[model samples]
Target chain A: MTDLKLALQEQAEDVDKVLDDLLLEPEGPEAQVVKAMRYSALGGGKRVRPFLVMASSRLFGVSEASALRVAAALEMVHCYSLIHDDLPAMDDDDLRRGRPTCHIEYDEATAILAGDALLTLAFEVLADEETHPSPSVRCALVSELAKASGMNGMVGGQMIDLMAETRELGIPEITRLQRLKTGALIVFACKAGAILGKAKDIKMQALRNYGHDLGLAFQIADDLLDVEASEEETGKKVGKDAERGKATFVSLLGVERAREQAHMLSEQACRHLDVFDRDTELLRAMAQYVVNRRS
Target chain B: MTDLKLALQEQAEDVDKVLDDLLLEPEGPEAQVVKAMRYSALGGGKRVRPFLVMASSRLFGVSEASALRVAAALEMVHCYSLIHDDLPAMDDDDLRRGRPTCHIEYDEATAILAGDALLTLAFEVLADEETHPSPSVRCALVSELAKASGMNGMVGGQMIDLMAETRELGIPEITRLQRLKTGALIVFACKAGAILGKAKDIKMQALRNYGHDLGLAFQIADDLLDVEASEEETGKKVGKDAERGKATFVSLLGVERAREQAHMLSEQACRHLDVFDRDTELLRAMAQYVVNRRS
Candidate 1:
């Protein structure tokens, strides 16, 4: 495997370990929610968000331990969103990462509570003194993460997506939806390092720009994979977007054009790294890997 | 109306105004979630949590403006929990505060999104500089609120309640469940004033003790109301615990014994206020009003 692939796997494992240590088995009747939380959060997918957090933090010479905690927190938020989105009242999916979804594995109520608890835990983790020595930095982290995942961001995007199921959306509308849905969190991950290191304005802006292009490219690639990849390759059911008549980049731009756009965005995302003198080769490699991967 | 009743009404109106101003109508496609949030949060029943926050803050001479912001945040958390708990997979209630529950007024997906957004907004509000001048204090508020509402507190209590529906729970287990579920947040509300004022250790402990007894009394009162009150009086369905065969204080202890317990606890709760000579007459009146309330 390439260096980026190895680094990604290492970071994923590190984050899993942090999450495992943070979430303890319940000794009371409420064990069911904790079990559901574990089921959804542990031993899961690519951990792409955690990888971005770690890579970005590394650029600023942040301690690996601090970065891992933030990564774990971000992953918890991401996992909670997935668990809720897959509930019977929402996407109603039975499988995720080739395993039964939280609601399918546990019960719907437990799934809901688990998702709520995970989101709560994410904020708790960020607010804790262990995340940062400075209270101001911790507050900034909390504010940024909350904004990224809250009504104006991920949740708002999900609402729009749910309403758009029966309506036909144009390319600009689809782009806006994807940006809010996935781009916001990705931007937070990339900018988190700057906040942690107290980086200057120019450097912070560079990472933000990089994250913006990379997130769009990543989503476009995901759209392409949904159109072309099989369940075995993707570890998830494919073509559901088409079956549900969901408007995606692939559906709007065609396979060839969508792929070209993703590639162009990935290259543009790499150009943002020119502002940093340190080794950003791994980040550049990630941009290419995100667009090129089958899943 | 009595002094306590008048004070409660005034505080409720203040919290409603704050919540209304904070939650803006959406200008985008995601208006559905924002509408659901407003539906559940605005013009609701007695703002009990907000009242507790304001009353507690008053002990420390915390500014009403600052206290109101914290109260509004706590109410948002309470509202979010109600929205989620009333979902079909959970309590399955049709009515809340004399109107349809969030899911009944809106779609299930919108309700879930609204709940998620409300929870997120609670943290964002607490983290903002407007909530507190010191970042450390804001961080403390966030940490306390998160712990009170997360897996080991309210969410954990909810899980136990869900599981206990199929199992028999004794009085001790029930007390523990209630303490975790509802008592935690109440205690936080009471202690928030101390934290904001940076009260002395003895004073903080006294307030915490007061909160503990008062929360239990409040829960008992709620259980009694569920057994005795009408739909119109409570603004919700009555006798749900008995209908579901869920164990509660009223079910374990006879109605007469439960009422006696609440009265005893209320008196005991007021004794903890002896450490302060700052005209705690309102808090003493609140204790009596809580147990004697018809709804």
Candidate 2:
């Protein structure tokens, strides 16, 4: 196995443990909501966002405990978005990661409450002093995460995506949509370590730039996969964007041009990492992997 | 007008302004969600929760700016809950505040996204340094609010309420449900002033006792309203508990007994406030008002 893949596995396990400890079931009828929270949040996905947090924190010498807490909180937010997206009123998909969606496994109301609970729990975990000794750091984390995930960010992006079904969008409009929808949280994950460490302005800027280029490149690759990968390999209903007539990167740019664009963005992302003096090979390799990986 | 009513009216105005300022119109298609959020969160209800925060904050001399910010954040959470509750899978109500519900006005997707955005924005408001000069106080607000509204609190209460539609619940079980659903946030509101001031343990305990009794009394009064009030008087659907065969205070204890219980608890809540020597008339009157008010 590759070194990056092994490191990602270790980080994913660490985040899973934290998530398990945080989502304890209560001894009441209401424990059903927590059960749903546990079901969707546990044992899912590649944990890419958490891995980004772990990798970035390593560069700053942040403690494993603190970094894991932030990673878990972020993963909770991501999982909540997915659960909401799969609801009957939203994308209305039955399957996610090769299993029944939250609303399919549980009732719609339970799934809604579970999504709400997960979102609420993310803030709770970030606010806890155990995440950081300094209250300032905790407050900063809450502030940044809120901006990235709220109306002006992920939710706002979703509104635009829904509107896209009825309207036409150009390249610039699509770029803005993807930036808010998916890029915002990815950038947050990459920059979270610098925020925790209170690093210098130059280092923070470098990570921010790297995250911007990497997030767009990653989304383009995801669009490419949606067109090419099968449902069995992707563990989801593939070709969904095209089926829904959504204007993804590949649809607008065509496969060849879009693939080339992703490659160029990946190299540009790697170039931003040169600001760091050492120990950047993992982050650099991640840029290339986003464009090259299958499924 | 009564002094308590006057104070509540004033506090509501302050909170409304803060909410308006926070929810700006973004120049994008995503602005539709923000519009929905503003519709549901602004210009409605008695703003009783914000009134509680303002009244409590006055006791400890917390700044008006700080108090208003917390009140607005609390109201955002309250509004978000109302939006979700009125969804088809939940309470399925078509009207709130004598007008179309959020989902009735906007599509289901927009309402869901708006609710999610409001929930996220509340944490951002609480974590801002403008809410308090000290990061510790901000963190405390975030932590306490999250606990009050998350899985084991308001959301849990909603879960139990949903289950009550199918099950037979006695007084103790119903009491637990009410405590989590509506009472927890009230307790937090009553105690927020003490937290912001870093009040002594004895003082915090006194407010807590006051809040616990007051919260239960408030819920009992609410159940009574549902039983007796008209749609025109209350600005919401009447007798939903009875229609759904859900157990409530009036359902379990009868109207006369529930009325007596509300009065008794109101007086008990007032007595707990005797810890403070002066300027508590508004709070004291609120205790009586909860039981005696017709609408």
Question: What is the total number of backbone clashes in candidate 1?
Answer: 0
lDDT digits (tens) for residues A1-295 of candidate 1: 9998898888888898999988997899998899999999994798888988888888899888888889999999999999999998999998899898999898999999999999999999999999989899899989999999998899999998998997889999998898899999999999998888888999899999999999999999999989889898887788899999999999999999999999999999999999999869888999999999987
lDDT tens digits, residue span B134-196, model 2: 999999999999999999999999998887788899999989998999999989988888888
User: DockQ values for all predictions?
Assistant: 0.87, 0.92
Q: Candidate 2, which CAPRI tier?
A: high
Candidate 2 residue-wise lDDT, A1-295, digit = tens: 8998888788788899999999999999999999999999994788889988888888899998999999999999999999999998999999888889999999999989999999999999999999999999999999999999999999999999999999998899999999999999999999998998898989888888888999999999999999998888878888999899989999999999999999999999888888888888889888888888775
Compared with the true structure, what per-residue lDDT tens digits does model 1 show for residues B1-295?
A: 8888899999999998989888987787898898899999994777777888888899889999889999999999999999999999999999999999999999899999999999999999999989889899889999999999999999999999999999999999999998999999989988988888888999889888888888999999999999999999999999999999998999999899999999999999999999998868887888898898887
- Regions of candidate 1 where Cα sits further than 4 Å from its true position: none
Scored against the native two-chain complex, candidate 2 gets a DockQ of: 0.92
Q: Assess the local accuracy of residue B205 in candidate 2 as a C-alpha lDDT between 0 and 100.
A: 88
